[model samples]
Target chain A: MIVDTPLLIITDLVKEFNDGEISTTVLNGLSLSLDRGEFVALLGPSGSGKSTLLSILGTLMRPTSGRFEMLGFNLIGARDVDLTEFRNQHIGFVFQAHNLLPDFTALENVMFPAATRKGRETPVDRRRATELLDKVGLADRRDFPASKLSGGQKQRVAVARALMNSPDLVLADEPTGNLDRESARRVMDLLIDLNGTDGTTFLISTHDETIAGQCRREIRLLDGRLARERH
Target chain B: MTYSFKVALRYLASNRAQTALLIAGVAVGVYIFVFMSALIGGLAVLLLNRTVGNIAHVTIQAPDRDPVSLYGRDSGTLVAILKSVQQRTTLQSAAAFLPAIEAIPNVTSVAGVVAGNGFLTKGEAIAPVIVTGVEPDQVSAIANVAGNLVAGSGDLTIGIALIGSGLAKTMGLQVGQRVSIRSERNIDATLLIGGVFSLGVSSVDDGAIYVHLRTARVLFELPDGVSRLEVKLDDLRLAPEVARRIANTTGLKSIPWTEKNEQLLNGLVAQARSGDVIKGFALVTIVIGVASALLLSTYRRQSEIGIMRAMGATRRFVVGVFMIQGGLIGLAGGLLGAGLGYLSLLPFPLPEATSSTGLPIAIGEGAYGTAILLTFIGAIFAAIWPASAASRVDPVKVIGP
Candidate 1:
């Protein structure tokens, strides 16, 4: 109940959705806690608000009423500029679709978050990005466009991009949903491997139970509520 | 914004069809703007230069009859106004011409003079001619009027009249022969012809003969007053402004020849306005092109825009990116328009087209300044809506699943 000086802490978070005359509740008193270096898996059905919770965690939306804190910055009250800076300095995200810029090569796509936060490209940023690309085994495909990569390679590049700034927290919403079973396992292993090696905490939402078994901790959501936390 | 710009550039470059359409639109707008400015500027220059060529600014004409009433101008007031205007610091030089203007002011050398309308009879041939009276030594200052007397250069020594090739052919007159001209103003006096001046405009050479103004007036028995005032300005443009001042100052209305030929003035004015209207049409086409190009471009990338917002890009970033795209299109089009217009002018040689061979081609400085301004303004205007649409992309989630 008291502050644990946690890496991420959310209390009584509620996000409501309205479809014209009808209003639907997406999250109801969704409380969660994550400490440093914790790898979390969020398992839910298609309409269970797993992605919504991730969006809130990433500072992409304001909770209807609740408290959210990340790395000592107040999430619910952050300005656009401050939130952007905070995201730049702390949070990283990977998606189910890979979502790489088709025009830029894999290396350049990985650097998008860095450039978005800081509008210039210095030599040091390039060096750091190339290092992350190497970590995700995409060093050879650095100049290849995301479209040219295999599903596994594209998701690998996505992981590289998520770690571009070496942030303390990484969010992966279905990091392997679009991949073959073998590729799904490989990307899951890579994310778990990175959590151990870099000590970067990760929160992942996945439908695959095999992917969920790979994480150190699991939080399952049912109908927009935290139904179970497995240790 | 810089990152957004980079994205915009990539987006524009990747979509070749969209980029081409936008540039084409922007270029058209730029072209119209540049050409309109040049055409307006060109028309003004033509008036200013031509007015100064034959007439002097700030002439003193007798205030007796209002020039508007057609009561005829007073040559007596010509000297008084000249003296008065000459005293003012604003005026450069003042020349007082007699009602019959037997002299050129400031310069003592008077070229061949022209007295309009004469009946010529030489060697059993009779042709109507415009009789010009010119001083023997002052032929060079007449410019085109000097070239008109190409045939009998040496005739002025013994007072033999030079005949135009056209007049010579028509009248059946030859060199060293005397022809008789009955003055139209007098109809009774016979003036001895000295030479012919063949100006290039057909009416100028075929219709005219050269004689001394003194001799022509003597033959016509005209009073010493010049029927019309021909004033020169340092810059012909100053003539209009200075003319307004003179009209206001002396209460004497002086009609510039450019004004006197109302049909020509109106025609030229209409030509220029039509040029602007054509330019407007070109601009409208460009607007349509830019609008559609941007609309298509945004439509094609609606999903990408949604994805970008999901990537945490702000609405402002998306909007800024699109705006920059518009700015770039406008800038590129503007540059192209200016370049195309300038290139087009290269074929029109000012020396050949203008009466003044010495008329400096002034396309250098003003044109460049105009192109830069037009390109920037036009490009931004063309791209504005499309870029705003980009900004209006509410975090692709609204548009995307």
Candidate 2:
């Protein structure tokens, strides 16, 4: 499933934040591309625009000036509604804080994308969600509320949710940033296993060098631009 | 169910205490609305019943004749004048109009009456009185005279009559006693008092007497037609329309009870307006309470909303979740409040003979349907601000840096 064709392309992307008299440029002329089914890690220090890049790629933020094409369609100037649908169909996200709806069960959290997209939960969605939960080693905890889960378990559920829609690309921002060493290892293993079996591409932003070493490619950002790349 | 609705339910179920408190607040507001509606509605009914119970809903009488001057055609001078102050105006051919008057919709009963001024004389005392004559069987058709009788029976025979308690007291007259009645037309007769009644109206209780129509014609010297017609209606509110129809059909002067009781109608209207203001305030309070609480909830769940947005949930979806929550609260609160209002008023009995001054709350008039519909709609309106705010949450800012 590792195709030679590129899945996404970025050129001369720029992003700036303004507060009255102050203008802070988060991404300045940064550009990168990813091929289908590639596992890439984004490495950067604090305030190095790693998260900003992930946000733009996930279609959650608009770049001030850039050319962004994902799945052969231009995304830089797309309408918000169109972008929302494109993201739901083509992109997935796992936040650093494991932002699952605390009131819902693990299985419900995993089924959130499909249920919201279809307007209601169907039998197929339930089956897929149950399978995802079992794959994440939380089959017994499928009915447990998100608030009742431990931090690491919550992160694992977040990963399962990001994969529930079967999106082509998953943008994970420090997915295991708040977990202990053992929990972090287990989550990373799960991500790798899913990528190898399903052929889903992953672009993970992380400060942990050990996590970056496990990816097929590593990208480093410095002062809002690509500083280095290694394979 | 739709995911939006499911999510709204989950959110509410997660915060049980807050949800219950919000619903309770809405219920209290709805209860106030229902209470006001029932009280004001009940008071109006009570007033109308008391006022219209003892009088005709519509009265048809002969048109008044004003004096006119005879002018000479050749000169601008008044030649002669015609004026009569003592002439009695009687409805001519009253019997011919009874069928037409009774045919009007909502007309329950119609009675032809002969009324005239007279004097009641006992052996040692004399009192001025008004003598009303009607058919023996229809004595209570317009006024409930039979129901108010305190002694003897409401019998109107050729030589027997009914007198008010005030007139009976002043002359020391009792049932089975004879009294002399002298009419303004100079006709006189001695009749035995068959009954005594107290109608609660001071003027009527002091001087009114009832006699047979045959005897009244002879005493008042009305040999041709009855004096006037008294009309009763099933619904007193239809009096004006019924009176209009009667006047058109009978060629007589018709008067409705509402025109005669202007002050009472005005008081009832003012009371209703005040109740509306109170009900309006209650709804406003409910709207404010729901809006503020939902706004807080939106703020508290910012990160969750951000996650949903990042997961490709549309702004409309987010809005639907919040609005559904508001609608649910409104519907539940409305039902609870209406039930509570009804149950609370059940202990207070309606006004009756045993308790004439009972609590004036009409439980059946609580306006439950209106309360529920308004509250449900109001709650949805209240959630607009919060729903919009939640939909506008920035996914990047909350979920990322």
Worst 10 residues of 1 chain B by lDDT: B86-95
Q: Taking the tens digit of each residue's C-alpha lDDT, what string does model 2 give over B252-337?
A: 99999989999987998899999999999999999999999999999999999999998889999999999999999999999999
User: Model 1 scores what on Cα lDDT?
Assistant: 0.67
Shift in Å, residue B217, candidate 1: 7.7
For candidate 2, what is the DockQ?
Answer: 0.69
The C-alpha lDDT values of all candidates are 0.67, 0.90
Q: Judge candidate 2 at residue A209 and give its lDDT.
A: 94
Q: TM-score for every candidate vs. truth?
A: 0.75, 0.90
Q: Give the DockQ of candidate 1.
A: 0.27
Interface RMSD of each: 3.5, 1.1
Fnat of candidate 1: 0.17
Task: Name the lDDT value of residue A83 in candidate 1.
Answer: 68
